[model samples]
Target: MTNSRGGKRERLASAAARVLHEQGVEKTTLADIARAADVPVGNVYYYFKTKDQLVEAAIDAQDSDLRTMIEALEAMPDPRERLKTMVGGWVDQRDLAARYGCPTGTLAAELDKRADGLDERIGAVIRTFLDWMERQFKEMGRDDARELAVALLAAYQGISVLTNALRDPELMVMEGRRLTAWLDTL
Candidate 1:
């Protein structure tokens, strides 16, 4: 019973993440999340007392996924390759980015406009990626590693915005190629 209850909670959080990504925080509701998770609407309250709590759970899930992805890249000995692989991974999600923008960036933007305290929580996703990229650059022995990491993150975020605005998934792929080429030159 405990395992089943935990699974339901996990399912709810995952559904909340997807719904929030598609609808933003303002439009997403507990009922929407419950429906997405195939859980009874009343049961949502059992897992999360409020929308903010569910949002926090979603953010935690995203952070965990990001850490896992970065850990995979860390196995590579060459920092440049690790960075390139990361760009490729983003490119692979071009279709999704075009449809919903970046999950973390879009959520952060919405929460930021609301003046809610959740901005810091959502921003942690970007910060984690930035920190990982900075470490990669530092591993490559670049003195300007922090700047490079910021530039790389900025470029990706800009690409995500453009992809969503223009409804052009190809743009992400093209930008990914350009970023890879630029990284090669560094």
Candidate 2:
């Protein structure tokens, strides 16, 4: 594809991701994404043939972001600090989480309920985070690393749900502090 075409596709994918996080898959329309991307609605078809394809592209974008975040966390010498940094990153996005919940969690929950074939795709998005967390815990020499990873991710998702439902960004910040303190203990 040409540079312009690639740029338009990337823009559409980004807009779709934002819309998906805000309105969810059930409510987000192609036109909504197109408008947000400032691309012609008809031109969206040139990039993605179907809404599912567009949604998949959004998921892929999010997955790429998760990979990037993990890569950054890898720079921390200590695994515990890396985990804490992950929590801090979430805290940094507290406002957005309060408004939309977690982009990956919300998408996974919504897609899971749909019973679509996209479950594996959505699972990969979450697995990337969980796997990284597990690796960190394992590096810390914890036998229950897998369990710890699950607990941490669950805590994040649970807090995110409350934050969004209660419209309180501080809830996430408080949770992040608590998680950090908990990490220090382990």
Candidate 3:
């Protein structure tokens, strides 16, 4: 419902996304999201019937953010430059990734263990990105666009895990530069 502060559902979903990313799905509670959103815990039920539903909303929130980012990148004139900037943007998150691992990756890994279909929803987010990357590669006339997209995203995710394990943001930066350089040659 709309309030003086804005839509409570949106706020709760946003807060749930942040809390879920920071705390992981198992560790996050609806009350925690309500607290973060500054909404009464009871009010959360009006928006989400259960924590799983809230998690689903948070997943949608994450998807929305990713789609928005893709839209921004779509504005770039060059597909190659768009790809480079995407890597750069990810590299910029190295510090946070080091602290909590990649947000999308963390959520996907954590949620995959669930019996419900939440994991598939999160997987769709990754596929969304992969599809976007593949489109960009295809735009650049790469016949192996899908494979290249997978390789690039896989590399980024691998470095994200290592960056967190090693607590070294530089690892992500170095890999980003390396990936961008490799992109320049294509």
| Model 3 clashing residue pairs (backbone) | none
Cα-based lDDT for every prediction = 0.93, 0.93, 0.93
lDDT of 1 at 46: 91
Task: Give me the runs in candidate 1 sitting further than 4 Å from their true place.
Answer: none
Candidate 2 residues lying further than 4 Å off, grouped into runs, are none
Clashes of each: 0, 0, 0
Residue-pair clashes, model 3: 0
